[model samples]
Target: MSESTPSTGASSPLHVAVGILTQGGKVFITRRFPDSHQGGKWEFPGGKIEPGEDTLSALKRELREELGIEVQDARAYMQVRHAYQDRDVLLDVWRISRYQGTPHGREGQEAKWFACVELPQLEFPEADQPILRRLWLPPLYLISDSRRFGKDGFLAPLERALKAGARLVQLREPHMPLDEFEEYARLIAGLCHRHGAHLLLNAEPESVSRCNADGVHLNGKRLTQYSSRPLDDHFWVAASCHSAEELRQAERLGADFAVLSPVAPTSSHPGAATLGWEAFSRLCATANLPVYALGGMRVQDLARAHQAGAQGLAMVSQIWGANSIERAVTALASS
Candidate 1:
């Protein structure tokens, strides 16, 4: 069940701790009681942190009480704030990296383990959508510099990068002819599929199906025009956002993730107004979707970007060139 809008009241957000316990590649989830709050919804198991208890302590207690498992290891993943009409919630989500026993719902909820890829098909609290996005996003997002690499120049290095573990890539070629772009997209799709990477066209929705591309990356203008997700659920949709409101719009429109731009000065738009790390952090704080800090970013900035609340960094210029692709690949392992 989804949260209901409130009539009126002073909203006090509830701070709850949720555990994402994993085994192999699957995470554990539990179903809410059919008659309870958010009834019948599937959720990561956890409960409210009691007064005088810290997050970890509360989490351990909750798991022991609700799932009969002792938390062996866990780390904070992401923090989210969402508002239902009647209430606001602060979800302190954790990735339970390790645990001791088999999980069973002692509270009478049905428990199951699901691979992250299978998570989207389940019904969850609206608040968990952001968590899902975070899980789906990779730590490094790459954008093609086809303009600079020009005709046959970018392909080899791109394949090298993919072979070296580039998982998420965007083929952004505004200068290329439409026919050439589509042909290239087909080749790129084959390469990406071979490397088990996701390929997104920085083009129209129609272009995705034509080339077997995974999805479309909406330019800021296209992002604004869409009232809802432009493609169906199977396609992974992303957008480039420049402001907090744009990020909000991306979330509202069900974007899988977003690239928030001009986080630092870039050659892409010389002398453009930059959102310094402080401002960038502030913008990302309000975001419910995974956001990558774009503009003048490189492999070295991955840690700094993550520290600033970004899922990762998205790069173009820094990712292309003679030895830069190798550096970008090395950064992935480090990030």
Candidate 2:
């Protein structure tokens, strides 16, 4: 749940441990008391952390006290920092997949389960906006490599990925001329929408609307060029980041999410330094937006990426270079 209205308490930001409990594709949420902070709004279940307590410990205690459930399995999802007129808050969100005892609000609050699609219709605290996005976003991000596989060859693998449940994709053909890229993006957008998927163009932000794409994926250089978010909230704005500074910039620019790269060695940037899992995790811990691990990523690395605090894996070679596109897609979907 959203943090209670801050008392004239400490000047420091309140740290809250939030949990997103899911079962059968639905998430559990509770409404705050009318007099509480963000009153009458719906929020995922959780509470404030106490002194000397870590996030997981705080989450377990809060769930048991508020919902009578014992958290059995949970993982770091994402963190959000927000400020109100009177207070600042840090939401340490976790995905709780396994728990003991059915959840029912023990605190006399209205609680219920909601399908992910229904979440957008409900009112929630401002800080919860990113949390909702992370919940709805897919576990795999497919980056198009049309330069390696020409326009003719790209559609085949793309179709396979879409059919195999790849819901999010980035059309990243930097070498193509803008006009040509826009044309290709429109074609890809049509194909993506047909499969109930979203297509993000790696061209100029304005081209996203022109090509009828769902969003824009800015490269690191392009990301720093924007002082503010280029597009409105209706369009998803994503960025490619390699350092903590870029991540902070993405968040400051109101990006929906980001791709953090070089978690492992890659053929494309063989000489570039890699972040590795350790550094990747450290960077992710500080990011306010959901992050995807890129570079040398394969379907098998999905779990490892998750453990390292990445929302998912963003891959190019593993998906486009696979011998069997269908097999690769299947494996990634199942992972």
Residue 258 of candidate 2: its Cα lDDT? Answer: 96
Candidates in order, TM-scores: namely 0.71, 0.75
Alpha-carbon lDDT of model 1: 0.82
Give a tens-digit lDDT track for model 2, residues 70-89.
99999887777777777888
Candidate 1: misplaced stretches above 4 Å? 1-19, 22-66, 69-133, 322-324
Error of 2 at 88 (Å): 11
Best by TM-score: 2
lDDT of every model, 2 decimals: 0.82, 0.88
Model 1 residue pairs with clashes = 6-85
lDDT of 1 by residue, 1-335 (tens): 12234324575567788998876667889998997777888998888877788999988888888899999889787676766656778888888877887899887789998897788789988778767766767788888887776758878888888877788999888888889999999998998999878999999889999999999999998988989888875687999999888998988887888999898888768988998999999998888778898988867788888899888888778777537667668666445
- What is the total number of backbone clashes in candidate 1? 1
